[model samples]
Target: MKAIEYRLPKDFDKSFIVFQETGKFFPCPWHYHPEYEFVLVTKSTGRRMVGDHIGYFEEEDLVFMGSMLPHVWVNDAVYSSGQATHPADAIVVHFLDNFLGQDFLSVPEMEEFRKVLRLSERGMALKGRTRRKINTLLKQMPPMNGLQRLSTLLTIFDIMANTQEYDLLASPKFVQNFQYESSDRFRKVTEYIMQNFDQDISLPEIASVASMGVTAFCNFFKEQYRVTFVEYLNTVRIGHACKLLAENDRHVVEVAYECGFNNLANFNRQFKKFKNMTPTIYRKTLAI
Candidate 1:
């Protein structure tokens, strides 16, 4: 779905913004802003959507996104219900690409960082040791002021530029054609699918949600998202299935039905197609 544009609160005291957010749930809707972002989920379990990528997130999850990458973290039911033991919390940083200066990244000293920034255009899931290190640095950033904060930010980028412990999040196809257009129909269709993905939704039903005919909706969805509507729906369902499997020892057949796949064999086939492992193997690997 095309994301709505979001404006971060301006902080004139500093050239960038860094702070900790804690609440019953994360309140941001699916949206994008014109600044690079660093997000560390300090305390939460949820699903995160980065461009065309959808996946699970848990405590200490770290992601870096460049300007205009649509994303949001939707807390799990427990946290959102306000019944969890602890509130949701995260460390979030937002900065313009040229927050230092218009010509800063052009300097020779920034060559490596420039490369990392380019990679960030596709969004990145910082992992392993690099993820741990950046999480620590982000937790320390809110207290510092002036040049000290800027220096720490640069250090984080330097570490990221040098480390291979990361995975690109969004697909290149999605990133290449994404625009900041405002479309209510598009937004409504996406929201409908997300909210009702666990139920069987027919083509006519979803197209009706977009106020379009079946053929028109199919073409529109493909043009906007670079994927068929069914394809995108399956991606969401499979992502949620992965989350369910990781969080518990649910039987695969039960998970399949819960994720809106009525046929167990088809669910296994789709799971293997997207995750590169059978559902059983995928769950077994987690036990390791």
Candidate 2:
């Protein structure tokens, strides 16, 4: 989907905004904003799209997105259609890079924070102990004011900067080439891939979508996405396979085929390459 630029409400009273969102479903479309966002889903089950990455998310899902990163949270039909009794709830904080002043993060003492901010450009999924720690802190933030609130945010950043329990969501090329205009070639290719990744997409077919020959399109895709077309396709398929495995009581072979893999062995190999675990093991972890 094409991402629109979303302007967040400006708050003159505070440098940042922290509040809880409770509703039948999250209503934001695929969009980008200029503020860095820290969001924790306390109650929900759905898919999350950050740049070119697509994955399933549930309660305690914590993610940090840098300024202008494209993203969206799509609730499952049960929640969005109001067929479920419970509501979706999340704690979200939004702040600009210069929220504390442009010079604040430029200081020598803030070097680690600078690195963290740069890494966040790809969007980040916090996991393991870091996710748990940040979840606890965010739950306490909505009621805090002034220095207490600011300090809490800094503490969360510090924890994130120091931890290795996180995954970068978007590819480097996606972060570098994303533009708000929908007619751009990169956007078109991205849209095509996202919409058709579940089907058998040949290089020539996608090249035609981009109005290029197979060889030229392959080179262009690699240059624009920093990965071979086939590799990128497998990555997307494996990512979706992860969601299916986590959310469905399906066999590994079934999930693989559903994700566009023609053979179980290739699916297992590619899934391991991206996720570092077998599908069965990954599903078991979710059960745990």
Candidate 3:
């Protein structure tokens, strides 16, 4: 329920923000930033939302998110409950498109890298050898000098530019304007929704949390996120269902009930609508 909140350091003048994470399940609510991001997960597993794409993630996962793409790392409940097998570890890098200046990409020599960065608008997953190399680079970031940092960043970008294993994560419709005011509102609303999404969440209930009336909240949500409140709710439910279906062999009806759908029929309908497949099929497909 904390929403997708991030803390920026005061007077942080560098073009990029870099850090390593461990221990906690930092479940950032769905939100976007104007800057691009590179993240390498060292140890952990959970549901990851990058743009419109949702999937399971495990150790050594790496991803690159373009400007204005919404994402979150929802750690498993075991981590939240302090029973994690290993502390979660991640190296995060964030920088603006113009961090190296507009002319940086204008240089004829950098065109290929420019196209690679553009492809990131849909988000990308980094895998295999590239993941290990990036992890080593990120681990060395904190102690590096300005020139060293630039060298490392360029190396990371070069690898990403040439890699063929990456895939786009979000759909085209998932793009949204990256305005601070709208993003703030979204953070608040999404936090409230994630916290109480498993229960009966009404428009009035969420609207109050956003400090807006129901009508205003509806318009605000749609305008900012391009999805109705109901749509978002169903997305959240389906996300929870996905986690359950993948992690547990519980009966389908039980998973439906726990995901907040009152009846199996409605749960099935909404799940199929969002997933383009039924829950049973989804589970079975994962099995095979």
What is the TM-score of each predicted model, taking all chains together? 0.64, 0.65, 0.59
Candidate 3: lDDT of 4? 52
For all candidates in order, the CA lDDT equals: 0.82, 0.82, 0.74
Candidate with the greatest TM-score versus the true structure: 2
Look at candidate 2 and tell me the lDDT of residue 195: 80
Model 3 segments more than 4 A misplaced:
1-7, 10-13, 176-288
User: Over all chains combined, what TM-score does candidate 3 have?
Assistant: 0.59
Pairs clashing in candidate 1? none
Q: Model 1 segments beyond 4 Å from truth?
A: 177-288
Better model by lDDT, 1 or 3? 1
- Model 2 whole-model lDDT (C-alpha atoms): 0.82
Candidate 2 C-alpha lDDT tens digits along 111-147: 7666678768778899999899999999999888778
In candidate 2 the C-alpha lDDT for residue 11 amounts to: 62
Please write out the lDDT profile of model 1 over residues 47-118, one tens digit for every residue. Answer: 887875667899999999999889989999999889999999999999997888899988888877776776
lDDT of 3 by residue, 1-288 (tens): 122535445224576677777776765676777778887887888878776566678877888888877788878888878798778788788887677787776787776677667557767887778777887888898678777888999988787766676655554334443223335766777667767777899889899888899998899877654458887777777777877887889999999988789999999998778666799987875564
**lDDT of prediction 1:** 0.82
